[model samples]
Structure formats: structure tokens, C-alpha cells
Target: MFHWLEKHPFFFAVGVFVTIAFAGLIEIVPNFAQASQPVIGTKPYTTLQLAGRHVYIKNSCNACHSQLIRPFKAETDRYGDYSLSGEYAFDRPFLWGSKRTGPDLHRVGNYRTTDWHENHMKDPVSVVPGSIMPGYPWLFENEADVETAYAEQLTVKNVFSVPYNTPLPMKDGSKVTVVLADTLSDAQASALEEAKLVAADMKDKSVQDAVAAGKIPEIVALIAYMNSLK
Candidate 1:
């Protein structure tokens, strides 16, 4: 069979390409499928967190901070565990940033609290003295686009099979579900409900008033998104 194919240049090239393609599939497909599974403790982002992810993206937070943590003893000790592929299974465009003007935020939720984020975003130097990261006072003034976020959520749920509203297993063997609202208004309400929780931990009256008035500030959404990084 090899001799016969080698005699025909066209057939020989086709055979080589086919062989390489098959080999590539073997090396790539299984790892992809396995990595795509949600980590045992990983849950889908809620309406508020999803909106905050958008806020983070809108302000280009990923440009300054990476969401991925390298597997080094120094890195894990500072940034918690090394990142896993399954942990980002639900991320549409994973924020595994390349630059690090700030810090690795893959496990920010593990160490930082809501109040801490509020203070940090408002004035980075306040939290980390002499920090070069600029303050995002606009995040406090701007409102999160929960509408667009919900639309994107609907698209991912229907087309991508993101497993929203499904019970996901936790590290401690408990189960949690993230609901995607049916109506746009319901999505807004659900997002507002969660924003209130984040606001409860925050000291900023402006952020609190925005959440109470059913207007989620970009900072609130960004904080919620950052808090869900774990």
C-alpha cells in the first residue's frame, strides 16, 4: 500500500496530510474534551457576576491583570493553587491575560473581600501603598449593562450549552445552581439582588445607593465578577 501510494505524488501528499491530521486529532481532542469539563467546585457565573465580567472587560482590566496563575511554588503560594483548564470551562473568552501591570487575579476571590475591592478600585494606593495602578472612579459613576449581559447569557445558554440553572458539585460535596432568568426584567432583578449582597460589604454610599435604586454601578458589577474569580 505504501509503495503504490508513493508512486502517485498527489496520492502520497493526501496520505501524508491525512496521517498528520489523524495524529493531531488524537493528541488534541481528548485533552480538549477533558479540560472542558467543569472543575468539581466550579460553578457557572450568575447574572451579576456575568455583568461584572463585562464591566471588567469594558474597562480593560484584563490588560493590566492576568486571570491565569502559573504552576510554580512561589506563584501558588502567593496566588493560591495553580490554575486548571477545567476551572475556566465556562469562560467565553477566558481572561488569561498576558501582561501583569497589576497582579494575578485568578484567585482574587479567595483572598480579597467585597470591601477590599471597593477600596482598591476607588484608590489603589489606599489599599496598597505606593501602588501604581490608577483609580477607577468612573466605575462608581458608570452603570453596568445588565441587559447586554443577559442577552449574551441567553445566547450562550441556548447555543453553547453553558449549564446554567443546573446543579453543580462543590469541593465539599455540596451542590449549587446558577440561574439564568427567562425575562430581561427578571435578569435585571436577579442581578440587582446579588449586587445588594456585594454592596452590603462595601462602605461606599454611592455604590450602595446605586444598588438600592436598582442601578448597578460598573464598580459593583466588576467587584462581583472579581469576587467570583475563585
Candidate 2:
């Protein structure tokens, strides 16, 4: 069978191509016809959460940590439910990624606390002695250029929901305008608003704790974002 397939390589290749094309087209037809395409759930981030996501991305955390869990029996047994498609509604270019150097963080939200998170960030070894994770002390030292970088995040939210037009007021009183929605459906708007409020409360408490401790890092925002997973 191998020798005959090699001798007729072009024909075999063409046949394989045709079969794949037919399968691909069939799979996409339903997707294209759906009226309500899945919208990823996203809400405006509090300053801290936005900063955290930036930290996560800038550090190339994706290089080691995937945000997805497989639905196979073994994966479900190990990581809980197979990741829900709806759960990732807010992720763009979804982080349901390819590598697994550490572990699936789909539910890391419930696993640790702020102080514990800070220790891990400051020196992974202090928390997990055998951890291969790199410490992110730069997060402790660097002052994020809050105005310019965070403005871009508002732009993205505007694109997703027209009612997201409310501008975030910076501490300096400058307003960041968003273009997404003037009025989201009641449910969508409520959910987004609730998420923002919760994130804000978390940021305030985290920052207060850091200040009280005096050993705190500047990027409590990033920590809040990490804790928001799932």
C-alpha cells in the first residue's frame, strides 16, 4: 500500500485535498449561517485588571500557560469541566492556547489569595519551592504608563459593545472615551457593569493591603487580573 501510494503521489494528494475541502466547507456552513454568532463576554476592566492582563501578555505568560481545558474524560477528571465555549466569550484571539508548561488556569481564580499571589510573583520559590516560574519583581518596581496604554483597552471595549461609550475617568480627571455601545441590552449591560464594579472593589482592597504591608509591588492590578480567571 505504501509503495503504490508513493508511485501515485499526485493523485493521492489531490484526493486527500478534495476530501479535506469538502469536510472543511461542511463544518463552516453552519457557522456562517448562524444569526447569533457567539460574542465573547467582556467588560471594561478596572485599572488594576487591565494592568494585570498587560503584565500577563508582556511576560509572554502564554508561552507556558494555556487558558483552556480539554473536554476529554481524563482532562475533565483532572481539571474539572471541559472548558465551556461561553466561558471564553470575552477573550479575543482566544487564549485557549497551545502550550501547557505550567497548568491550565481556567479555574485559578479560586485557588489562591492576594498575599499568596504576591509572594508567588515576588519569588515563585518562596511559595512553590520547586517552581520553574520566573519571579516578576519588575511588576513590583515599574510604574505603568497608565494613560496611554490603558486608553487602548477602552477602544477595544467600544468595538464589542456600542453601549460601552462611557469614558473611564482617570485620576487626573482626563476622560477615556469608548465607542462600543450607547446602550447594551439590559442583561449585557448589567453583566458588564457588575464585572467592572467587582473588579474595582478587588483593586481597591488589593492596593490597600499592599500599601499597608509596605513591601507591596506597584502592579497589584496585574495580580487582580490573574485572580479574575474563570
Candidate 3:
């Protein structure tokens, strides 16, 4: 067979191509599957966080900021750590922006505080000197659509089988479960409970009042989403 293939260059080339392709698939497929699985600590977003994500998307935050962090000294130093593929497994559509007009936010939850986010969203220049980013004062007034967020949670839970209300393993050998309410009313209550926690850290009186009255502002949800990035 070897002597016959040497005499036939076309067949020899085809055989070589097939051999290489098969070997490549064998080497790549398993690694790709493993990397695509959710990272041990990765969990689905809660209702409030998902609502904040909607706000983030509505404001086109991804256009200015990327969630992906490259494995390099400068990037890892500025961002918390290099991004992993498994970390994005739960992302419906990944937010790995092509360009970064602002800083990456994959790990902003770690370094930035709720109070800092509150101040920055209301007045970007106040938090960062000479910042070109515009303030989102409206976020403090606009109510988050908890119903839509709840609908999304239901869809993902049913269609994609996103693990909700189930204990998920963490990197520290601990387990954490994210609750998904059974009804819209319950979800709103849960989100309000979370919003109160974020509102407690903010100095804005109006925002605090809104949460106290069982209302969730977009800024509260946005802060919840931002804090969950870690």
C-alpha cells in the first residue's frame, strides 16, 4: 500500500490530508468541549442582575467596554485575571466586544464598590477625573422591568436548561444556589430584596426611596449586574 501511494501523488495527498484532519479533530474536540462547559464557580444571573444586564445592553455599554480579558501581563494586571471560555458558558450571547472604548468589566465587581458605581453612573467625571464617559442620571429614575427579566429566566430555564435554584459547585469547594422565583410577583419581591441591599450602599435618597416603596430602579439592577461580574 505504501509503494502504491508513492506512485499516486493525488491519492497520497488525499490520504495525508485525511490523516492530518482526523488527528486534528481528535486533538481539538475534547479540549473544546471541556472549555465550553460552565466553570465550577460560574452561575446563571439572578433576575435583578439580568434586568441590569438589559439596562447595560440598552445603553450600549458593551460597545464601550469588553467583558473578555486577554491573557497578558498588562491586561491581567488591569483586569483581575485572564478570561476563561468556561466563564462565559452561561452567556446567551457573549459580550466579548471587538473594541474597548472604556475599561473591561469582567472583574469590576471585585475592585469597584456599590457606592462607587452609584457615584460613577450618576456623574462619571466625579468618580474618574477627566472621564469621557457620560453620566446615566436616568438610570436612577427608570424602573427596571422585573417582569421581562423573569420571563427571560423562565425561557432560559425551560429551553436551555440553565441551572437555576440548584446548588452549583464553586472553585473553593463550596456550593451556591441562585433562586429563581416561581411567579413574577415572587421574582419582583426577590429582586426588591436584592435592590434594597444595593440601595443601602448608595447615597441617593430618591433611589433609596424607590426601593423602600417596593420599586427597583435601573441603576440598582445595573449595580447588581456589575457586582455579579466577578
- For every model in order, what is the number of clashing pairs? 0, 15, 0
Q: lDDT per residue, candidate 1, 1-230, as tens digits?
A: 88898789999999889999999999999989998788899887888888899988888889999998999999999999999999998899999999999889999999999989888888999989989999999999989989899988999899999989899899999998889998999999989989898899999998888788889999888888989888
Best TM-score among the predictions, by candidate number: 1
Residue 52 C-alpha lDDT in model 2: 59
lDDT for predicted candidate 1 compared with the true structure = 0.90
Q: What is the TM-score of each candidate against the true structure?
A: 0.96, 0.60, 0.89
Candidate structures ordered by TM-score, highest first: 1, 3, 2
* Candidate-wise lDDT, in order: 0.90, 0.59, 0.94
Q: Looking at model 3, how many pairs of residues clash?
A: 0
Could you give candidate 2's per-residue lDDT for residues 1-230 as a string of tens digits?
Answer: 76786899898898789999999999987776552343343334544455556667778888898888887898767666667665554455467769899877776765766667767877899989799998887776664333433454555655765324565554366766434323324333432343343334443454445444432234565666766774
Clashing pairs in 3: none
Please give the ranking of all candidate structures by lDDT, highest first, separated by commas.
3, 1, 2
